[model samples]
Every structure is written in C-alpha cells, then in structure tokens.
Target: MFNISEVDKGDSDLARLVSELDVFLSELYPVESNHCLDLSAVSDEQLRCVIVRDEGNAHAGCGALLFHQNGSAEIKRVYIRPEYRGKKLGEKIVSAIEGIVSEKNSRLLQLETGIHQQPAIALYRKCGYEICDAFPPYTADPLSVFMRKELP
Candidate 1:
C-alpha cells in the first residue's frame, strides 16, 4: 500500500521531489511569469507540506496544505511523478489534505492550477471544487484558475 506521511523540509528525497515539482511547473509556466511556488523560500512550519511515498523508498509526490489560521486554507504544490500519474495518486493526496483542513477547522479549501492542466481541473471538479472568480493576490493573472471546496 502507498503511504502518505508528514515530511519536514530538509529531507533529501523530498527536497529532490520538490525540485522536480518546481521543474514541472516552471517548464509549463515560466519562472519569469511568477506563477510557480518557490519551494526553497519558506521553512517547514510555515508551509506544512506532505509527501506520499511508495513502499517507504522513493518519493512519488509532494503537496502542501497551507493555512492562514482562519477558516480557509490553500492546497498548494500537489504534484505526482510522471510515471506515477493516472494511478489516482492526486486524489489520494487531495483526500489527505482535506483531512488536515478539517482538523484545522477550515471551512474552505482553495487551489490554483493552470488552465492547461485539464486532468487536474477535472480531478478538482470530481472532488466537488467549484470554479470561482479570480480571487485576490491572483486576480490579475489571466493564466490562473481558482477553485474551492466547502468542507462539512
């Protein structure tokens, strides 16, 4: 069984996985475009990122459930390795993040995925996230998409 675990920032495997995430986003959206998250910028506590591993060896994917400590949180940097895609790993990560959001009393989970990521958009929709207006801090970017899901 694939297991998802809470990870600290300094882990080498996770650091490499996060680097891959950066490359994936940047290759799709340029660094000059100011769209992808700079994985090296913040410390562990500030982000609360998570990783899903395969049999406790290779890091298959990584995601972060970031909170403003209010009633909202952002599900950011969710990425799966190319070889590991289509196995429903994205949904599993989202489900794991949802559990964290619930525990934090967050009523809504927000996300920003690119327009070209149709599969990701479909996954978000399947998970009950509705397309919302371009929210602040992301309103000016035409390439940005905002979606949200309300928790029970």
Candidate 2:
C-alpha cells in the first residue's frame, strides 16, 4: 500500500515528482508554457500540495489544492504514474486532497481538466464533480473543462 505524506516544499522526492508533473503538463498543454507552477518553493502563492509514496524513494502520485477562501478552492495537477494507474491510486490522491479541502472548511471544489483528457473527466465526474461553465482565468480556453463539487 502507498502512504500519503506531506513534506516540505524542499523535499527531494517531491521536487523530482513536481518536475515530472511539470514536464507532463507542458506536454499536455504546450501553449500555456507555465513552468512557474512546477516549482518546489511555496512562494506564499501555493496553499498546499500532497505527495504519495510507496516502498521506493519515488512518488506514486501527487496533487495540489489551492485555497481561495470565499468557501472555494482549486485542485491542480492531479497525476499518477503510468504503472500506478487503474489501481485506484489516483482516487486515493484525490480523496486526500478533498479531505484537506474539508479541513480548510472549503465549501466548493473547482478544477480544470482538458477536453482531450476523457479518462480524467470520467474520474472527476465519478468523484461527484459536475461540468460547469469555465470560470475566471480560464475563459480564454474553449478546450478547458471546468468542474465543481459542493462540500457537505
């Protein structure tokens, strides 16, 4: 079983995983070219990140949640390694992020996925997120799939 752990932004394992996440995102969305979001430093800009690791020194999956208050937050870069997919590790990472949101007393969970990413859309929808009109900062992209779920 994989263990979900929160480490400092300086953690080496997390640094590598975040690098991989950045590279993957760049490949998926080449036009954005946002390398700043891939940094290991918290910069007061990121609220929190969650990293999961197995028996090895590498990460199995990783995800981040940003707090916007206003009873809302965004889930970003939820990723799992190819070998770990279909084993529900992605769901575990997602559940962990949602739990963190709940702890922060967030009432809404909003996320952006790509239209070309059908499997991810299915996973988010299965997790109770519903399709919604694109929100702020994402209005320019017609390919972006914005979704939100209300916390109980």
RMSD of each: 1.9, 2.4
Candidate 2: regions farther than 4 A off: 33-46
Model 1 residue 140 distance off true place after TM-score fit, in angstroms: 3.3
Model 2 lDDT at residue 1: 71
- Model 1, residue 14: distance off in Å is 2.1
TM-scores vs. true structure, each candidate: 0.89, 0.86
> Residue 15 lDDT in model 2?
70
Alpha carbon deviation, residue 90, candidate 1 (Å): 0.5
Candidate 1 achieves a global lDDT of 0.79
Report model 1's TM-score to 2 decimal places. Answer: 0.89
lDDT of 1 by residue, 1-152 (tens): 68888777666777788788777777777555445655567655456778888885678988887775455788888889998898888989999899988887788888888877788899999999999976545664566678999999
Top candidate (lDDT): 1
Tens-digit per-residue lDDT, 1-152, candidate 2: 78887666666776777777677666777666342354444454456778888777568888788776365888876778778888787788789889988888788998888876788899998899999987765674666788999989
